[model samples]
Target chain A: MGRRSWVGAGLGAALVGAVGVGLLVAPAGASAAPPLPPVSPEDLVSSVMTAQRGPFAGEVEVDNALGLPAVPGVPQLADGTSTVRVWSGGEDRGRVAIPSPDGERTLVSDGTTRWAYDSRDRTATRAPAGDHGGPPEGQQQDPTAAATQAIATLRQTSTVAVDGTAEVAGRAVYQLVLTPQPTERTLLREVRVAVDAETRQPLQLTVLAQGQGEPALRVGFSEITYGPQDPSLFTFTPPPGTTVRDAPARDGEQRPEGDRPRSTVGDGWDTVVIGQAPQPGDGRPRDGQDGQDQRPEGAPDLSALGQPVSGPWGSGRVITTAVATVIVTDDGRIAAGAVPQQVLTEALAR
Target chain B: MTTVSASAPPASRASTRSVAPLGRLAAAEIRWVLRRPRTLVLLGLLALVPIALGVGIALTGGPGDGDGPGLVAAVAGNGLVLPIAALGLALSLLLPLTVATAAADALAGEAAHGTLRGLLLAPVGRVRLVVMKAAGVLTVAVLAVLVVAVVGVLTGLVVVGGPSGTMITLSGTTLGLGEALGRVALVAGWTIVQLLAIAAVALAVSAFTEHPLVVLAAVLGGLIVFGVLAAVPSLEWLQPLLLTSGWTAGADALRDPLPLDGLASSTGRALVYVVLGAAVTVWQMRRRDG
Candidate 1:
């Protein structure tokens, strides 16, 4: 009996120890980078631009360190890690589903018609494709779209390099780094794009601000699978009893009275977009269904945030985050960008 | 206890009883556990929570217009979310607490009553006794979760879904009646696994102490500590080892084209705890003498 008990005790101890060891080692193995052949930065950039985007589906995770306070009417760029699923069937067909605790917000486009549905409110908005606004602001979620846009805007004003080969979403990728030129006045230090080695598609985009150790923003695929997705995934019909609304034709023929026209000042990394905060219930497209955005009365008090400041641009508040800053003027003209206070003042002065 | 020894014809026959059939032992143990007054009361109380939640939302017009948790706020019009949300809320503490109570009673309560000595002296071997105790705890966990889920769905359908049983998914798609029930069942099954892991740990703790309250305190206290550790961002390296870290992953069932990463990882973590807890209980039982 003594020997049998001893054997039983030993086996139990061994099994528990094995679990601890396995947990520790599994992460280290998943993150270890595999060896790959070197490629030039120029060649990698060209390859990304020319690569054909075929059918594929994946889950993308966004990590935001922007430190922006929750403001009414402003899209809350997720404060922590949020996951969204993306599917692309080449050309104009695509779908992105953003699932929240209460319900999901899904945007689907099948080449010609686009549908935006919010399950929380049971509302669906249908619009013809090719609207100038694209998904309301801050809804362009696919990593490939974000990466390509960053390259197009910053390539001429920055130095590009291929730092090394790394793995993203379990796929080998070339790390393409873009650093703003010495003459450029911007808060951003560099942007890194991870391009899949075999497919030449961008799988992740990381943006870093000056002096910050952590990336200011990271939009990347957490898990991805290449090849054909269910064709039915890209189509949408509002479930019965949904309050369906047809989006008024926004063909640049007429601007709604509540629409606050926006204009940009300066160029490249320091550009500031200025626009008036639209009135409550102005029917300006809402990209999210957060509680803060649903207030039936007066706009979310912008006065509750940031320190008050007066400049030649006029008296207002300047709200700052890790990656961007916004100044809401007393007269309601708001200017925002990734530039410093001095640059914003200069742009406002102009 | 006296009848077992009285029935033994000879000393050699006692050796044969040591190898008790596992099925019979489990059946007897589960019956004993279910008959306990405390277990019945705890499960009955659990059934009331979802009904209260559903009625409150129906009368109050849904948690004061969405200031509440998303799932609770969504319960106004969508009846299917009621069961999932109730489980999610209960999973944090109440469900684990209920399972812990049964596990504590499995060995500690019996030992405190002096009945454990009779079972220990009986022909049942130490390993088989430990297995039977674990089975009793398992039965309690399964019944506690099913009672909550079943009551929640009935309350939800009656209060919110009404005659048009159609409900929307988090992905903005609608579900048929069959599909909605399937999702609720999936959530219930996943919750059972999590509760089982918690029960296994409570049983191990139960074996070490004669006072049932100590087992309850130790298991619940450890869970609270795991919650504190998981909240600290710098302690992320230690989060993976905590049993509470994956409790919220059960919400994955509510998603359309469900993402299994969180749910799968959480299940794997719970399985590890289950094995470790069972092993410790077996090892402790072998050393214990009547």
Candidate 2:
């Protein structure tokens, strides 16, 4: 009888343990008897993206105890771009350095291509059309594209439910709850978003972990604009004194038929397509160092070859030298192809 | 033959009486623990600190960026807080009192109550009784440590929210939040193990002294001596050998990508302290004359 009772107890304990595990592993939404309405991922993306385009403006307040001051009078550019200029109020309290007072980045996009320019770097880069890996370096994220991608990715990896309506940034929005799919890469098992019901723009977002814990991110926007923007705002031009280099072609050399110049000084000269003439301290062979060398009569000093460039490329000097050609794509994709220098010249000439 | 049989019954009765005293002794010891105000206080305080720290951190604008998992990584995440803050509130002030208070009464308090001789006369074996007492004390210490850990972590989470992965500033690399929390849990566990070593040391001190005050003084003195030795930079090589060296091993859990340096050595040292202290105490108790 005792043995039989022990077996019964063991079975009971096992049953309890199994139930507890199930309760933990079960999706939060699964407890409801009736199934809710299914949300279409594509529709959600379109709505969020559509609401993101605007001609609006407002101030954003950022509070960082690590010496980030509250930036007031921050301007939101007409093309949905935002800019804030901060100054050293008094002594440096160790906030991360902003390049300069004008060290602002403006993000502009026309439903399709997106571009971001850092006024301090004097460089602009664009996002690839239709690609989801996000924009290249120097380009700003299209808020609409980012919102769309975030929603799509979340939907693909989670069971989502509309958690009713709420107000965010003074706008009425729909609240969403997401439960994780078995193969999700995120640590969060659930997330909530306050999206504008009519426009589909996300007003606020929050991520919650599986276990009892605090929310990971709580971000709310100040103001959002929706409507058509000036078409010319999307176009970008290289600043004066800036060099525009053509992306290198695949084969690492210029095709003979291309209209680009072919220097007799080996492929290295071809690789030098659009940079400024060398300056003093550049570490290149000075005109007197190699008697065989000749150049245009008022050529800038070539001595500064090994010296760091003063532009954005300076930080990436090591990477540029190791690769055959460095091409900054139209959408700001920085790619290094094994193509020859002559091919880069030809591609740029076109 | 009738007389002999009658005498044998008395012998049997005496043996029964002897065994009865063992049960009474065990009951009395348990009651004493239950009545102890210090033990209750220590347990209560340990549990409260983590919650308090968590709330404090949260109200203070949350955990600082450097205070998060990533900073722990840059320093190799050994989990030991400098100055022994890793003990949370216990090491800060409560732990020394817990050790001293429990062990001080081990032998001396019995003598003070004039029950030392009665306890020695009991049928219960001396070595077994001492071992049991030590076990009870160790249990209390372990409980205190556990309370601190659960409370501290819960409070930290409430204050700072969930762990965000290690923030590698230079590389701008981040790990998953769950991984960071796991690291924090591991650090808390290591701290418990370190506290267990201190408990063993206190138990050993208790076995040698009959005065509770002397035991308390000895345990506290030993801790202070070791703490002083730890602060001497020139004796750095000996730091890892100290039982207290591994106290902050939990700090290792805060690293984004966990670092294992010094962990093995610290754990080994703590284990050695526990084993050696328990062994010596058992030997002494077994050989002690009633």
Q: Against the true structure, whose lDDT is highest?
A: 1
**Candidate 2 Cα deviation (angstroms), residue A282:** 18
lDDT of 2 by residue, B216-237 (tens): 7777777778888988868866
- Report DockQ per prediction, comma-separated: 0.38, 0.02
Model 2, runs deviating above 4 Å: A1-350, B1-31, B62-89, B157-160, B163-185, B287-290
Per-candidate TM vs. native? 0.83, 0.39
Q: Compute the TM-score of each model's chain A versus the native chain A and list the values.
A: 0.78, 0.35
Q: Which tens-of-lDDT digit does each residue in A1-350 have in candidate 1?
A: 68786686768667675865487337524576668789877567667766778889999989888887754322327477788899998878999988765567889898899998876666789998887456534234444465556556667778878888889999999998988887778889999999999999999999999899999999999888999988888888787656899977774334653355888997777888888865556655444434443576435544557888889879888888887888877787788998887787778778
Residue A330 alpha-carbon offset, candidate 1, angstroms: 4.9
After TM-score superposition, what is the CA distance of residue B42 in candidate 2 from its true location, in Å?
Answer: 1.5
- In model 1, which regions exceed 4 Å deviation? A1-43, A71-76, A132-156, A248-267, A271-300, A309-316, A328-335, A346-350, B1-15, B50-68, B73-81, B153-167, B222-239
Error of 2 at A71 (Å): 34
